[model samples]
Structure formats: structure tokens, C-alpha cells
Target: MVKQWWAALIAASSVLAGGEWQNCFNGKNLNGWTVKVTGFETGQNPGNLFRVENGLLTVSYSDFPNNSFKDEFGHIFINRPFTNYHFKCEYRFLGDQFPGGPKWAHTNSGVMLSGQAPETMEKEQKFPTSLEFQFLAQNESGTRTTGSICTPGTYVDVNGKTIKQHVIKSRGTALPAGEWVQAEAIFKNGKVSHIINGKTVIEYSNPKFDDGTPLTYGWISLQAESHPIQFRNIQIKELD
Candidate 1:
């Protein structure tokens, strides 16, 4: 179960804690990012699903036919991996769901944590082995929590107990639609915490692949699961 536990831990405390913040999203282009769409080879952008517009790294669906998404999930990942760091970003749901995604993905998009390399994933793989720090937007109708955790081909532990199930809810309330919500993740001391706005929403430790390989380091990626979302201010700080 321990692929050596990544050999270390990474975390994001307060950005105010301040090391040096690297702008993962330069706000101009996807220069250092890699695209991986389901059923497509790595580095392929089948439908222009990911792009930069108006200085924001965006996930758009204008190319898909009306009511014809066909479950074409995708991700754009940083070119390299990281360990013992803090990650932060701003996101807002836009447009409508692509009509083919699961109901739970209606207002969902996320930044993947401790994810497998983009190049290693199978062409038809829906998602990589990673912990998802999901951002759920509020529809003003019912209860939903932002900054929740979802394991896709991965798993984590909480409170010193083994939690193999997927979809762990967070304490943070659902943020309003069309508004930018601040989301962050801190991987430190062998534990990880999800922060929404200014509060810690969910926390866990011991991330591992479904096959039980320890995830000590991984690439940071943004999800495009049939929903249009905007991600900006993507930054990271490696802890000393």
C-alpha cells in the first residue's frame, strides 16, 4: 500500500504563510499544460475543450452539438509533478451542463490532487488516479457542500481510520453560481485539507492509488466533466 508514501508530505497552509507563489496559470495561454481527453491520446484536444480566453484558463463546450456531449471528459494538467506544497485557485461555474454528465457533475469541477501523470493514463480512462478537491456551485435550491473530496481511481484515510468510499462531503456550504469561489488544498505532514473561501472544509491523509500505491507526488490538473467552468489565479507554493 505504500509506494513509499511518496517519501514525504506536501501541504498548503495560508498563502499568507508565504514562500514564493508560482503562477501555474499565467493567465495568457496553456504554455506549460498538457491536455488529456477521454478516448483521445495525451496532448490531444479533441474539441477545443480547454483554452485560454480573456486571460482566464477556461473549459468551454461551444464545439459540441446541442445536447451532444457524449461523455467526453477531459483534463489539462501541469507538465510536472509536485510534493509538499500548497495550491490555490478561483473558479466559477458557467453556461449549462453538457447534458451527458452524471447528475452530481451538474455544478461540479475540481482541481485534482496527487494525480497520476497525464501521459500514463489510458486513452479511454475517464479520470486519473487522484484525489479530487471538488468545487460544487450552489443552485439556490438545496443543500450542497463545496470543496468536497472524490476519489477517482484513488483513495485516502480520515481521522486515522480507513475510508475506502468515494465522495466525502465537506463542511463548506455551496458557493453561489456565476461567482468566483476560492478553493485551496494543503498537503502537509502526511495530511491534506480542502479549504473553501477562508475555512478548512475537509481534511484527509494517506492518499494512495486504487492498487495501493502511495501518492507522494503528482501533477495538478483541472477537470472538464461536461460542465463549463473557469479557473484563474492558479498558484502553488512549495513548502521548505
Candidate 2:
């Protein structure tokens, strides 16, 4: 069933308005998306955790009770499954990490691809089954890179070898927290590539579930990993 859906979507290969690339985000509101967050029922955004202002989509925490970050991880998902395309966006960190958020979560967020639909996720599920293009800021220390891959409930083969570890580092350089960084992922069949700022940093193939089930197509989601982040210029280019 899933495989059939993947094939149908991939075969469509629709071009975006006026060109080969389509702007997934309309830059005004969350129109073609769904929200799922922990500590709240699915689709219940207690705070304006996901909002757009001045044409920038922001994940904020100003409205949570006590204005504290309470592990309320969230995802804003594009409303469909996709395959064989290049997804790209620009993002930057903003403000300090809300109190009680994990130290590692400061300035950390991701774009999750090949993920299950928001309706299928458990109410308290921490993450979806997908490949995460983990975006990290320099945090002023200047050692963390932005284009790493974190597999949650999935795995991928890289360099002809299966990596048992969860997070795979990319070769991209890290950028400062305040700067908008360009992050992208290209997918064809089961092969995936992560690019940061126009540089190809990671490449892997044969993405599959932990139980060895193949993962060919799924939803695209922007993560709210307990931080304030902003994303802009979200677009995709369907490939042949």
C-alpha cells in the first residue's frame, strides 16, 4: 500500500509555479500543513508555537504556560507524501532556549523527511519515523555542523556500509546561530544527499525502517525541538 502511494507521487513530477521549483510555504500562514506536538493533543497548538510573521515561519515558545519549555517537541508537516525531489530552506536560531529545555536542544532543529503522517503518530510520540536533516548552530563555540543526519525509527546505508549509530555527521561547515543557513536534501529512489550552503556534505542510500521495511516515500516536516527557530524560503524541485 505505501509502496504504491510512493510510486504514484513520484511519477507525477509536477513542476512548481512559474518554474521547476515550488515554494512549499506561502510565507503568510500554515495553509498546507498539520501540527503535532508533545504535551498537547495532536493539532492543538497551545501556544503560537508555530507562526508566521513578516513572512518568516517561526517556532516560538512565548505562550506556553509559565513561558517555559517543557519538552513540548513539535512538528509542522507538509500535507502530503513526497518522493524524488530536492527540498531546501533557510533557517536561523533566535532568542535563548526556554527554561527546562535540554542543553543540546538550544539552537537545534531539523527538517524531517520520509516520515509517517501526523495522523498516525501517537499523542506523545517524541519523533516521527523519518530521516532528519538535523540543523545545528555554532552556539558560539564553532564546532557543530548543520547538515547531519539523525535516523529515528529508520536507518540508511552509507559508503556501502550500514551505520548502526543514530546520528551521522556531514562534512559541511558550521555557521553562526544568527545567520540564515541554507540547508537542503536531495532524494532519488532510496538514495539521499544532505547539502549545506550549496555544499554536498552527506550521501546515503537504501533507507529502511528499523524492522527492515523499506521507506520510499513519506511526509516532510519542520521540527520544533524545544527551541525558537525561524525558517524561510522553503521550496522543492521535483525531479525526473
Candidate 3:
């Protein structure tokens, strides 16, 4: 009986892990994504803000003139829009936050899901209307969760009620600065799951725009929000 039970469990797990995953970051260049920044034109990475180095897709600000951030909130968006899929990536904070960045942006970044295309954003748009899988590492003095959700120009249903708040905390794992963390998002239909280090931290259903329109599909984006961060092994598998 134990042998039969183990076989069944493996079969069920395979169903949840359906379809083959393809690499979203090519590791050599930003070939399959578009870069958008608040001040610069779309696709213009003035400071090499987004680049691949040492086999990792890095969001670096070292080239910024005068070493100033300039409030150039940026997003490197996946080339295509996805509807039902499982996306995962590993990220780690590398160094200090850029000067002149938001005070709250210390060791902060995120992955944007259900987001509008880069082409559709206004020239000065800071963030797209989407659900953000907010990533944060503990500062030198305090603790912060790593897999929370932030809604910008959107809303999600949690606990069977619609929430319009901009930020919602998740019971995600907490880690010290400079430690690599794994974050995953599973989106099927209108439901979404945020996971950190293999634990499901937050779950939301029926994600839609604040204007009452349902958001069933959209592009994925990686944030470059005034922090030096590195992401690698970004892959996505389609879900039926």
C-alpha cells in the first residue's frame, strides 16, 4: 500500500508541474525582453542599467552618471504576454541602494505580473498597472518579508474579499542581506500564488483592474527599482 501511495503522489505532483519550462533570460544578453525606464525612452538603457554578466541577468546602476539614481524606476519586461503559467527565478541583493532613491527602497525590487506592455506605458510612468511580487531583503538593522504582493493600479481578492490596498504583506521567508532567495508565482486563470523558498506565502483570486475589468493575461516584468540586484535561472512553464 505504501508503494502504491507513493506512486500516486508522484503522479499528482507531475500534473501540477505540467509542461516544459523555457529560460526567460538568455544569460548572454537581454534578447527576449524590453527595457523601459521612467525618464529614458523605451529600450534605451542609458546606464547599462540592465545587463547580463557572469551568467546572470543583473539590474545594475554602476554606470549611472555621477552615481545618482535619478528616480529612473525601470522594468525589464518579458517579450510576450502569458495567461496561465508557472514562473520562477532566483535573486540576490548585490550592493548598496543608489543615492537619491526612495528611502523605503533599500534592498527592494520586484517581479511584475499581469502588467501592461512596455510600449503602452506613458513616458513618465513609474510603474505599470499590475500585481507586483514585491521582493525585499532584510536591512542591516531590521526584518522584512521577501514575497509580498503590491498592487499598482490593480486589485486582488484575498480571503474572499476584494482588497484595494497598495501593499499586502505575505507570510514569506525572511533572510539577511546579500543572501540568494527563490521566488515563484503560479498564475492560473484569475488565481495567483506567491511562494518563497518553497513555501506558499500568499494566495489571491480574481485579480482585476481597479476599474472593474478582469485581468486574465499580461506581460511579466523584472523591476530595477534603485537597487543593485541579480537574477538568474528565470524559467516559465505553461499550465493547462
lDDT digits (tens) for residues 1-240 of candidate 3: 111222333343343435799889888999989999997788888689999889999988899754686779999998777768899999998788888898888888999997887877788989988899999988666657879999998889999999999999999856876788999999998999999989999999998777777777677899999989999989998887
lDDT of 1 by residue, 28-61 (tens): 8789999999888999986678988899988988
User: Candidate 2 at 2: error in angstroms?
Assistant: 9.9
Candidate 1 has its poorest 10 consecutive residues by lDDT at 7-16
Which model is ahead, 1 or 3, in terms of TM-score? Answer: 3
| CA lDDT scores, all candidates in order | 0.83, 0.85, 0.85
User: Model 3, residue 223: displacement in angstroms?
Assistant: 0.4
- Provide the TM-score for each candidate, comma-separated: 0.89, 0.91, 0.90
Better of 1 and 2 by lDDT: 2
| Superposition error at 36 for model 1 (Å) | 0.3
Q: Could you tell me which residue pairs clash in candidate 1?
A: 6-216, 10-84, 10-187, 10-188, 11-85, 11-187, 11-188, 12-86, 12-186, 12-187
Candidate 3: segments with Cα more than 4 A from true spot: 1-18
Which residue pairs overlap in candidate 3's backbone?
none
